[model samples]
Target: MTSKSERLKDEGSRLQVTAAGATAGLISRFVIAPLDVVKIRLQLQTHPLSDPLTHRDLHGGPIYKGTLPTIRHILRSEGLTGLWKGNVPAELLYVCHNAIQFASYRQATVFLHSTLGEGTIPPSAESFIAGAVAGGTATAATYPLDLLRTRFAAQGNDRVYANLREAVLRIGREEGFQGYFRGLGPGLAQIIPFMGVFFAVYETLRPHLTHLELPFSTGGALAGTIASVTAKSATFPLDLVRKRIQVQGPTRNQYVHKNIPEYRGTMSTARAIVQNEGFRGLYRGLTVSLIKAAPASAVTMWTYERALRFYISLGERSVL
Candidate 1:
């Protein structure tokens, strides 16, 4: 049987985990909303979709002119709620995404230690490896739901699918299983670095800051913010490509007009961005991404940590 003191420690840990996880979910919603808006626009090449004549311009022009103008354009034409287009799917996806991410990372870390005889925290490279695998796996598992979310977000209350379930069912029925995994290569490309750097940097910084005796939340938030910004910046190009691929369809014919063959796949997307929008194209939604990711990642890490701590505490009490 567990001792009373041991039970209290475990209970405390469990409470911490629960609190952290919930807060992380809330934070991700707020932070990612704007970035999500921009990413969708750039990925879908909104202007091309909107204009019938210049629709084929996507083959050789900037998908999005710039961030502020895009936001203003969306707001003016679509309304403030337009900024939060497809927010329902976005929020729901985040909830499941974060739930899987936090829970898996925790479990993965333990598995790593046991299998590899590493410490609980693993090395920076190890953290990145584990994070990439976990992030990629989670994204793949949830790719269809994510695809639907991207479609809804891109269409923005256009009466596309009735809801998420309908969206998934419709896609599977209409496009087949492969349709659900559309843009997977680009998505995985983005997630590997996004999750890898996110966890690696956060894990590294958190410990160092803690050693300096700072409060846990303060350190976690700081580390999380930095990690999100860095990770988002590094992976911005892949993000742009993923969005484009996810939204490609007969109905979504914008990216098809270019005469170039290279624009078809992952490498071509990158080349096109460079040729068309220059470096700026790669970071079309970068500002919004930073705005969203900082808070979201910060809250996610903090909340997840708290939730895990709490769950452990409860387990200890049960043992006792």
Candidate 2:
């Protein structure tokens, strides 16, 4: 019989959680990468698909009007490999991001329980703060990979830098070190609250999820879908802005899209999107994003939970 303590982990030390998270991220990044590429292509397109004038724009059309259409366009235009456009840098980013985020989250949770408990802040509030800290730290640490991934996925027939190494070296040599972090401000803006609510919602639902007695995989999937949809929806605009900013600066000329705008900052980027494309522009790729987010998060959490269980069981045996 599974003991009460075994139903959910007490969370584990920072190192164990980190390893599990890295494993989870590596697996999920591969699974959801095609959807991720489709989403980025849709998000980075400045022209509104709703506009009939979209036909005039270089990369615009009904090409980006929906998720399936965008995928088809990429496949037709850029081939099968296009779907996995940025997988190289993306792998590094996802692995490091999850490792650091989960480790920090575990540490933050412990810190909260020791210092504050449920006395001052609520448990959900503690989760929110911990998630924000974890997301911000991970996003910042692995941001260059993120920027590189975005650039790689954002390109079409025209190439920017031949490979990951060329892109990194060119950005460093040409745009300087700051080039690696072009959109970091908005990235943190998007992630902090996105993850804050992601954890808050997951932790909030977890007790209830346990009560349902679903199998581990099914329950994790349900929880991940709910948390991911809610959080991704709330902060998606900033995500759009971040991708747009990353493609700007010294190398703008090489893109297939001729008229991409350069914005001053986050608000500026957002304002331009809204003013030109209207409110719907802020959520350009939301459908595909939610689609990608669900499986990615579900796989990540399911894998992490299983790994945590294994680690805990191993520890127990070692003690015996």
Candidate 3:
């Protein structure tokens, strides 16, 4: 009977993991979608082409004055649907990414405790390590999909990619296989530190909330906000680089457009953006990212943790 109960508990944990992951994806999207639209527009330098008056030369590449105006511009020109550009790919990537991120973090935390044998609750450092590993592993596995997602997002709100499958084929045919994984290195660089800070701050804050007697959901929201700010602050430069590489000039086969100078690879894109736009250019969307990321992370982590706890509770009752 004890063995059966344990088995039931294990199954419950797995179900909790899955539910938590799904909720994380949903929450992440809801929080990030608008900011995502702005970030991509900033990254793609969309304003320069769309409206002559709003564009300005900042440190280098074209810059927009602020988020509210930019959003207004997109809505005016592209309609309400413009705000959710590339939503399909974004949703797809979020679903897959969160599944791995949340589920693996739970398993990894358990594994770390077992392997270390100290078991007095894993340290914050352990959480950071687990998150970095999870983010890197998951990103590496699904990076090509992420690249496509970025491309779809970065295109102006007025543009469309037909479908993800069509976009993938077009990219491969026009840009070669390596194009599919553009900016992967910078993306990984951004993610490792981002997740490291994310989980580290979150773990640290969770206990503080428990001490304050706050509900778990409230604690989660607080921790996630802190984590998101810290993570995005540390990794914004790499994120800029990732965006640049992911949305480079026209592909080799697209003959209609005049050839902008070609970047040989991700390194070239980084060098070009830096040399041309200066350090500020490397953090093009930094402000908007913070605005978007804080709420997004707050909801994602809060939703994921609560969902996991609820599912686990249900599982336990069923076992009893």
The candidate scoring highest on TM-score is 2
Off by more than 4 A, model 3: 1-12, 46-63, 119-122, 157-160, 210-217, 249-261, 264-267, 317-320
For model 3 the TM-score comes to: 0.82
Clashes of each: 27, 0, 0
Instruction: Write the residue-wise lDDT of candidate 3 on 76-128 in tens digits.
Output: 76677768777777777787788888777766776776677433545788889
Better of 2 and 3 by lDDT: 2
Tell me the lDDT of model 2 at 20: 88
Scanning candidate 1 in windows of ten residues, the lowest lDDT window is 253-262
Q: If the candidates were sorted by their lDDT against the true structure, best first, what order would they fall in?
A: 2, 3, 1
The digit string of per-residue lDDT tens for model 2 on 1-320 reads 76322332466756678888898889999999999998888887777657665334454323466788778877887899989998999999999999999998877776776687534787788889999999999999999999999999877777887998899889999999899999999999999999999999998887777446555466656787799999999999999999889989877645655567888699988999999989999998999999998889889988888887787777778899
Tens digit per residue, CA lDDT, model 1, 31-88: 6676677666655553323344422335443334567777876676568876777777
- RMSDs, each prediction? 5.8, 3.1, 5.1
Measured by C-alpha RMSD in angstroms, how accurate is candidate 1? 5.8
**Which consecutive 10 residues in model 2 have the weakest lDDT in total?**
54-63
Backbone-clash count (model 2): 0
lDDT of each: 0.67, 0.84, 0.70
